[model samples]
Target: MRLVHPLSVVRDAQDWTYQDVVDIVAKATKRSADRRKAWKWENWGVEPDAESQAALAAALGVPLGEVHRLGWPGWLPDGGPVRTSFPWTMAGTLDALDDTLEHAMPDRRGFMKLGGQTLTLLAGQWLSQTPDALAAAFAGGPVDEQLVEDLESGLPRLRRLEAALGGHRARLLLDTELATVTDLLKQASYTEKVGRRLLRLNAELARLAGFASFDAELHAAAQRYWTTGLRVAHAADDRALGANILKSLSLQCYDHGLATAALALATAAVEGAGDVTPRTRAMLLLRQARAQAACGNRVGCDRSLSEAETQIARSTTTDDDPAWTEYFDPAEFHAQTATCYADLHRPRLAEVHFTTALDLMSPAKVRDLATYTIQSARTHTALGNADHAVHLLERAAQLAASAPSHRNTTRVLTARAELPMTKKDPKVQRLDELLATLSA
Candidate 1:
């Protein structure tokens, strides 16, 4: 058995893929590597050329001499692997949360991590884990109920601020708040009722922190928050919240073209969520539909979308659902529907849904509004409405400029790339110029 290549092991430990290594090598050492050549180094244990080894060394922040001393995999830095298979117990949940808080710093590499098989394994664990297998008991100072309630009450306000400003502005604040909640859980004694509520709050804060990290384009940070949040939610016996975190991870994976993992996560989300409100089901199903669409499962996608629509229609303002889920209004529903159609290459249908969503969306959701606007412009471009597309791009550009979200700004950048550079129209040229300045 050619034991798992050390090169491959090192890449996994660093939470990167072949492309990430290639790009980083070029950036770090100004040396370009053919993808096929790099793949052989990992898959076939081929010794890289001196320059390639030097580039890899620089990318991994290791001494170049190590390449000669240890050779190949031996010279590669061992950063350790990212852990995902935590036991489904309260103690395990606490440990996961604590580990992430202490060590999972933001991915300074600013790239998505490789999770090909790990994502599937994670969802499988979530699906099979027992719900609230053990009760939590804490012996500490008395926890003030009012303080817990105050923190809970402030959640909506934090969300509002996140929607109005960008995630970068809100992420640190969310992390700080989560740390406060975690400290209370560890040090302050509370009744069973209070403890449960605090645990749920911890879960929600972690989930919100993940969402903020994603919006800020910190992929590894988002994963840390999301996985920890899922464990916390499971500990609280909040199946719906746990499912919601899975859906968020699914969306992130889908955004990065990890279709298999995205689909697995989505399936786990719906299957694991028991006895949720109609809108909550709708949100999860919509995510599942997108993954299905990405996988070319038109039948499954259509079925899931239809079911999502039915569930959403049944949802009412009076439903006893989590307050955070109220955002699954007509706007969010249609936007997700549009995403599925966009992935399926049905631009006309996507444009129609995007139009409806924009019509219903509140201006307060600046980051979302800006992102969807850019996406809607892409559909317009696909439909060959160049003139109208330019108009929409201009509108999206203004929206993007107003928001500080790295995600929203990235959408604008992507849209700029999709445009026809040769188009001499002043509006098109102007849109490009305005977008080019954003990253600067």
Candidate 2:
């Protein structure tokens, strides 16, 4: 889960034979990389010798000494097809779309290990990319504008499904939808206008799918989906949505305790959010605040949160914001801000924002409500309000049971474990029994 060998990413992109790497290394270094050694080098946790690694690096066009600095797979290309690396182009986007469609189900590895170089490269590419040539038409079934619009209209419903069910239950639907769009892109012909819209739709779908995977805690799937989404955004020339994807990736990193990488992605998201609405900008800023808090940058976190509050108020009056961002109203802003305070260990302030978030949050946002409820319970525990804390845990447990999310289940367990009086409090003891059933 941590170290994805370059053999997979590069071989898939270049259609290299299994022995190709062995041959290349042998040719470069005149070293013995036999079949067993090559097999270990390509697919497992085994580290190749320095000389062999150098030879492979050379073959991949990586700097020779990079092997020593990054140490094995860290020095390898991004954890994706090499062609989709950077300087976004139509060809790269198309290849990503096709690859996404082909692999609707990535291996659900338990951890996400996005290298620093990969994340940095993607952010740089998004910020630097401008309109390239439109993709040439493909030879497949004919696709009309009407079908594309119909798909576009249905996107909101899918988003709702993901929000309600979280990624575990909803990713299959999103992936299917993504596949349909990819089919249209690759198997049909359309006008440039239609093509652009289709690409935009695909990009959004990929983003949703990626987040769903993240929500479900399928880390590898999330990385693949998000990376593909970023590439599709480049094709559609939609930096706003691309920035959102970057933020999503940032959240993934932060949740996994990758503060520095998370900060990098969040910084890029804020910087690359070009010409977005006030609300959208607020969303990006809020994300930056969260990343800053994760990085222990109290000053930066406070600054971003202050700016985000000002922008959220203005975003309310505007009607031109993207539909995917409709969740970032006043209620969600409090929830997000509360998240930052929780990270900063300002339990009292976190309680205030969580309370407001709970009051203003719509019933439809079950997942968000559940998340805030659990965090609220923790804050109450810190404040020595055991009874109130137990009450919140009860509500959070209800939401988790009703929704059936492994991620939420894990949260419920963690929250229960953190309760100061879980052993002595009868209500908490009963809660532990209930928790047993949930975990089971």
Candidate 3:
């Protein structure tokens, strides 16, 4: 007879408790009392005796005395060789989580040490399953707060991960996953649940790639990420997510001087996200107005802006908006509008919007500060106020140095370049010097 570990049998039978195991054994062997006597009986031509117990003990690699002490004849063993199995069994799952926590905690001790590579791995695993498991791993506490806080604090790490992945690798990974997800979604049984998961994954992948492309100075590539992200969001039937992706794409287009494309994309986003939550509608409208302004469509820009403001005012509560969509506020909308006006050479309007945006900005967003300061500086330069432009530029440069973002650096450099042509005054020399320093 082949021997099996008694504990393994208990686990397999879902009878881990000693009382449950005792009941199971009594039922299996048909012995209400005297388990030893039952084990000593030879029945159905199977080995069942003291000699069998000794043999089972040897097979289990445990001492015979230990088996006898348990008050069992031990026809089967206490510990025996079992067939190799998948490593992700329930017990293994707990073990894996423990091991992951052990490895992750020490490395993540400091906020500065957090990176995208680690967060991606951890988040991918944690977010893949039910929140219950993750909560249990965290000692049965709430997971939502931790997840949000971690993601917010780990944005820089995610940015680095994007940089490390680059365009080609990111594209390949996203395309492959997209194909697999598409196939999965075709199955009737998995159409709803799995489709939603695939859509979320696709959106996240594209967002990451988009950020990477932006960091690498590949605006076109970034646009592609947002475009694909929008498609995936639509497939998932997440209008809010689709609108957000479109907003991002529009901003990319505007930044790259494709103002018309930006407007078109933003318009499409608003239309496709029809009857969406008020906040989302307002955000899309804001993006549309910004794009129109950038393209010099003053009347259209003003109309869109008015519509956005109206929608924002009507949205008395943000409860209808998606969780991710909460990042956009009136300030961010106004700041982007200011950037559009600055691009259109409407300095007064730009200044008003910029001032509003500056007041609304949080101290934690250093990168955003650098970007907005650069935009403000450009607006001042366009108005031929070289002194204010220089001062803003100085502050922007200082912030940019700390943030060290390629996109922000490029924006500042481009703004500085424009100053030399716009200002014939001696300040042009200072602008030239700043441009040289940026180049160096």
Q: Taking the candidates one at a time, how many backbone clashes does each contain?
A: 0, 0, 1
- lDDT accuracy of residue 213 in candidate 1: 77
Q: Rank the candidates by TM-score, best first.
A: 1, 2, 3
TM-score of 1: 0.84
Candidate 2, 1-440: lDDT as tens digits? 32235556666666666578778888888866466676776656688778787877877788876777878677777454323453477776777777666654664544565665678777877788786867567787667888888999998899888887878789999999998888788778887888889989999999999888888887777888888898888788888999999999899888878888888898999998888898999999999999999989999999999999888777656458988888887888998999899999999999999999999999878878888899899898888887898889888888777666667887878888777773867898878877787777
Q: List, residue by residue over 52-165, the lDDT tens digit for candidate 1.
A: 778778877789777789776667754344567677777788788877676545443244444757777877777777766444456678776787899899999988877776
Better of 1 and 2 by TM-score: 1
Candidate 3, residues 1-440: lDDT per residue as tens digits? 21123333423334344344334445544545444333333222234445544543554466867867754433343222211121322233333323322232111111111122332232232223231111122222222443334434443444443334443334444444434433333322322444355445555556655555554454434544554454455445566676677667666666656776677767767876656777778888888888888878889888988888887878867356765555577668878788767767789999999988978987655667778888888888777786888788877877766555667777887778766454556666665565566545
Model 3: weakest 10-residue lDDT segment is: 105-114
| TM-score of candidate 3 versus the correct structure, residues matched by position | 0.55
- Model 3 misplaced regions, further than 4 Å: 1-191, 420-440
RMSD of each: 6.6, 7.5, 25.3
TM-score of each: 0.84, 0.81, 0.55
lDDT of each: 0.80, 0.81, 0.56
Model 1 pairs in collision: none
